[model samples]
Structure formats: structure tokens, C-alpha cells
Target: MMGSRGTSAVLSRAARMRQKLQSSLEASALDIEDVSYQHAGHAAVKDNANETHFNIKVISPKFEGQSLVKRHRMVYDLLTDELNSGLHAISIVAKTPTESGS
Candidate 1:
């Protein structure tokens, strides 16, 4: 069923975030897990907090030659908006396929 304001087609926040990361990094593999439940009552600003915490594991050739800092920065750049809008925290494991033993 479509939403009255045409928002029904909009992907969930986590799905959209995953899509953005995949596109931005050309990720060979991506796993985005919503870990908000694990951090109950841990958020600074708890208003409208949906999908605030996450654990992301990404394997991509784009990260092959990058330093850990650079790799994390790349992922953070892709999620700028989410971070700004109260994405409380994220645990990111960014690696190349080779490094990931995959």
C-alpha cells in the first residue's frame, strides 16, 4: 500500500544508509546491523531516535590500499547526514576482501 504523501516507496533509514554506503564505496560485501537495542538509554539526545546505533562490516576494493583512518573516514563521509541528525554511534569494520579473508 502506498502512503498518502508518497513516502511509502521510501526505503527504511538503515536500508537507505546501506545503499548509500554500497554505492559510495563500491562495496563487495556489506553488513549493516541495527544495534540500538544493545545501547538502550545510552543516547545523548533521545528524541526521534530510530536506528541510532549500528555495527557495519564492509569489504571493498576501495579500501584495499587505504589506512584504517582513511577507510573509516570514507565510511563516515558517506554517512554525514545520519551522523548530523543524531546517529549516536557506529562500529565500522572496513576492509578489503583480501584482508577480510573472503
Candidate 2:
């Protein structure tokens, strides 16, 4: 583990981000995967093995009419705090229900 507190803090932040996105986006489906292990030795990562990167997939009707840039921005905006606090990167896959092949 990432010095215990570091891992817990990172996980807590990610959980909070998930909660916020779930509530704010009203997503039908949402998945947030901690991808820090994939970047364990990168310079941007200062927290040893902490959760510094994430891959997020969300499906919501809210995304139905949004541009891709706009949809990405919406997620980034919601995660401003995490970004400020050592969340080095994010990959977002936002889709409407229909766009998700549902």
C-alpha cells in the first residue's frame, strides 16, 4: 500500500467524486476505475502508489444533446477538487443511453 493514509485519502477522494458525479449527472450507469497502478513510476505522481489517475464511464440522458467537449468539461468541472489535490489524470467516457447501445 501507498503508505496507508495516501491510499485511503486517494480512495476517499475518488469515492467523493463518484458520489458527486452520480448525484449531479443523474447517471443511469457510472463506473470509476482507479488506474494509478498503470502509472506507478511517473514523475507527476508524488504519492508513491496512490490513486492519481482514473477512467470514468458514465451513461446519462443528460449527455444526449451535449458536445463531446462539453461533456468532458462537465466531468472535469465536477472533479476540480480532486484535480487540485494530486489527481494527475482522468479519462472520461460519457454517453447517453442510446449512445451506449442500450
Candidate 3:
């Protein structure tokens, strides 16, 4: 008998990033925008690449005591796999909940 579990669902890059950040950072707010279209003609981006560029904004307690560089590093570390897998660039706006008036 075949099992009911057919093909597993694949998560989009933005969705995957959101899940990772939300779970790891306990973010009060999170936004991920795919900006690949803006870089369509850029030399580094291939013509067929879809989720190559992103703009991320996140506010979390995890960033409370971290410096700006540290916060950016934390975000980069979390998305290392994504970065390695054709995610070419990201503009991150990471902030503490307090800093964001949350």
C-alpha cells in the first residue's frame, strides 16, 4: 500500500528565511522582500535566478545587546545556507524591539 505522504512541500526562499528568523530570533516583527527583479540585469545575477536578492527587516530581543555589526552577522549566519544556494544579496535592517519602539 502506498503511504498517504506524497511529495513533501517545498518552501519558497522568502518563506524559509521568515521561518528561520522568526524561530531563532523570536522576532516582534519580521519582513522579507524579494528584490530580485531590481537586479535582473546585474552581472552577478543570472537570468533565471528568482530569489536572488532580498530586503529584510526584523525586530527582536535577540538583538538587544548586540552591536550593529554583530546583529548583521547574526542574520547572515542564520541564512548561510540560503546565501550559499543562489541567494546573492540581502539588505538587512535588524533592530531590538526597544529600538524599533515595539
Candidate 4:
């Protein structure tokens, strides 16, 4: 029973978190997709009805010289507020211009 207050709250929270990351990092490229709807009714979702999963693709010079784990950590730190609050899992794909062949 994913009521209005259940999923929407997390979705809104996620959107705001993404917005903050985008603005703060001024990322060269950033993509945030709301895949929560797709996970609904799925086995893994299990009626969590919260911001439990995400696939983030970020390309920024800020990531230069940073290892994959460090880059992801940077992104996580930016959204620490949300992650600590309720955001569960985040799948990050961070890259720099050189690494991305850009």
C-alpha cells in the first residue's frame, strides 16, 4: 500500500537532492531518472515505496584525479543529508572527460 505520503515524499526528496547536487557541483553532465515507478510491483521493490534505488551518471572535471570510489564518495557527500535521511541505495557512474572519451 504505497499511499500518497509514502512514495511521493521520497520522490520529492530525491528530486530536491538531485537538484542540490546539480547546482552545487555545476556538473558538466548530469542525469537523474525517476525509476521508482518501474520498480513498483517488482520482486526486489517489495513495497518499499521510498527512494531506495538510483542510477546516477555524472561527468564533471571535479571528478578529475579522483578514483571511482572517491568520485562516488564526493557525490554522496553532497547528498549526505538525503542519504542519511532516507535515500537507500545509489548506483553511481561517475566519469571525467578523459575517462568518458569526451
Question: How close is every model to the real structure, measured as TM-score?
Answer: 0.84, 0.85, 0.90, 0.71
Clashing pairs in 1: none
Model 1 lDDT tens row, 2-93: 66457524767688688789988999899999988787776474854678889999999999779999999999999998899778889999
lDDT of each: 0.85, 0.88, 0.91, 0.75
Candidates 2 and 3 compared by TM-score, better number: 3
Taking all chains together, the TM-score of candidate 1 against the true structure is 0.84
How displaced is residue 101 in candidate 1, in Å? 2.3
For model 3 the local lDDT of residue 52 reads: 97
Error of 3 at 48 (Å): 2.6
lDDT, candidate 3, 1-102, per-residue tens: 445343213678998899889999999999999999998878998866899999999999999889999999999999999999899999999999889988
Give the number of the best model, judged by lDDT.
Answer: 3
Off by over 4 Å in 4: 1-11, 37-47
- How many collisions per candidate? 0, 0, 0, 0
- After superposing all C-alphas onto the true structure, candidate 4 shows an RMSD in angstroms of 6.5
The TM-score leader among the candidates is 3
Off by more than 4 A, model 3: 1-9
| Model 2 agreement with the true structure over 1-102: per-residue lDDT tens digits | 479456545457678888879999999999999988999989978859587899999998889889999999999999998899788999999999999987
Please give the RMSD to the true structure for each candidate, in Å: 3.2, 5.5, 3.2, 6.5
Q: Which ten residues in a row have the lowest lDDT in candidate 1?
A: 1-10
